[model samples]
Target: MNMSVPFSLLFTLIILFLSVLISSTSAKKPGDASQDLVRSSCVHASYPNICLRSLSSYSGPANTPGEVAQAAVKVSLSRARKASNYLANLRSQSKREQGAFHDCVEQMGDSVDELSKTLSELKHLRSGSFRWQMSNAETWVSAALTNEDTCLDGFKEVTGKVRSDVKRKVTNLARVTSNALYLINRLDQSRQKTP
Candidate 1:
């Protein structure tokens, strides 16, 4: 006959098995609660805008006020001129590329003409408006976006750049002008205060 198991040994084994199970369960790590939280990291460091800091800190050249104005106007006019040049180039190319379905490009070319003309007007308008344009640069930015939308309409893959470039130049000019005018006003206020 088989010998019966010792009661004390069986109890010891049961207790050992229970202790292992309890230890394993207690040792489980809690996952971090914040791991599930969505965090969008910073897209860009907040830089002070309008190149003011850049201009202010600029020790490379002692830029005169009129020199600054001249430089800015030159930059703006150059952009307008480039936009005009792009339209001219596109017009020339469209003249060469006209075909069956492609014949519609002539109309697009005409649309480009319209857009270019508006851009030119805006370019000149920006010059005159530079004294006090855009009560809010953000609102000005929104308007530029509208201008972008208008430019993008009926545009093919090609002029997407032309449209975007036009918007960028125009917007940049507006920003520069705002900064210059603000500087001017500040200077005038300081002069009044001193004298």
Candidate 2:
């Protein structure tokens, strides 16, 4: 008995198998779905570029609107903490704008606290109480944004580098917080549409 396969047939089979493997590998990455969800979630944000950039690092597990919102809040909280520390340091180093620095630092602290609360609420949301929990998240995030604006407002009357520097930092922080709030609102809207 002689068993022989044609070279052409073997070559075709090899090509077919390789094509299937390539297609499977190239179609989507391991976490592409989650990343896509993150991108889509950021689209409606007030500052979409900031939202996408800030939340990109946390996109791996952001498979849902809620998860993306949580990521946004986490980013906001982290930035708020950094901003608060920066303000505190500036306050300590400055003697001229004592009152303004102190007020800005205090407001940034409040912003950080509100962002933390928003993150905590988002992380603990349950399907049964998702609406109520989302509402809480929205409120806290809004408060955080407000606190940031107030921090910036403290420097309005001041002139020169201190005000400019504080304004730059606080403005960046506020933009991120605004994006987080927009994402949270999108999440809330998403929940409302689900029957």
Candidate 3:
């Protein structure tokens, strides 16, 4: 007796098996509460798209507003650090716009420091001093946003590719920082509302 599966049946079985395997290995689940919470938190951000995009890779539990704020601050801090490094490297290689690059690098450095403080404050928030800690986080994040804007402003008098590149990078950093600040403010408000 010769038993052979039809080619179409074999192909269909293989496809089905692969699909099942892929679905089983997928990380995201339908109606995931953590993901829902993350989306809701991002809704309140000034740059909601930017907030969601930046925060998409955050692996922390999104069970609370404070956690979302912490994640946002972490994203902002990461971007700020990268921008600072980029500026430093550009400064070393550039001839023209050296003064502007120098100032931008210094401002970006301050921005990184402020974002670091904000992240630290968020991480150590105490129930007894919740309001105070949130206030500090807010202040630090806002300061970081300002610092990023100042860096971009330094390029106003400059022209050409360097200026445009600096503007693009710094502006994006400022946007993400602004979104982080918005999320932080929301967390503070949420705390205030809880009895």
Could you arrange the candidates by TM-score from highest to lowest?
2, 3, 1
Model 3 stretches with alpha carbons more than 4 Å out: 1-31, 91-96
Total backbone clashes of candidate 2, pairs 3 or more residues apart or in separate chains: 0
lDDT of 1 at 39: 10
lDDT of 1 by residue, 2-94 (tens): 998899999999999999999987764432111111011001112224434334333332233333323333333344345435544553235
Candidate 2 lDDT trough over 10 residues, lowest sum: 90-99
lDDT of 1 at 155: 42
C-alpha displacement of 37 in model 2, angstroms?
0.9
lDDT of 3 by residue, 1-195 (tens): 889999999999999999999988885775376677889988867888888887777876667777888888888888888998888987434554788888888998998898898888988989999888888888888888888888887788888878888888889989998988888888888778889
TM-score of each: 0.31, 0.85, 0.81
Q: What's the lDDT for residue 79 in model 2?
A: 83
- Tens-digit lDDT track for model 2 on 1-195? 888999999999999999999998889987888888888888877888888888887634688888888888788888888888888887433554787888888888888888888888887878999889888888988888888888877777788887888898889989998998888888888788989
Q: What does the lDDT come to for candidate 3?
A: 0.84
- Order of quality (lDDT): 3, 2, 1
TM-score for candidate 2, please give it.
0.85
Screening candidate 1 with a backbone cut-off below 3 angstroms (N, C-alpha, C), the clashing residue pairs are none
User: How well does candidate 2 score on lDDT at residue 167?
Assistant: 90
Where is model 1 more than 4 Å wrong at Cα?
Answer: 1-48, 53-60, 63-159
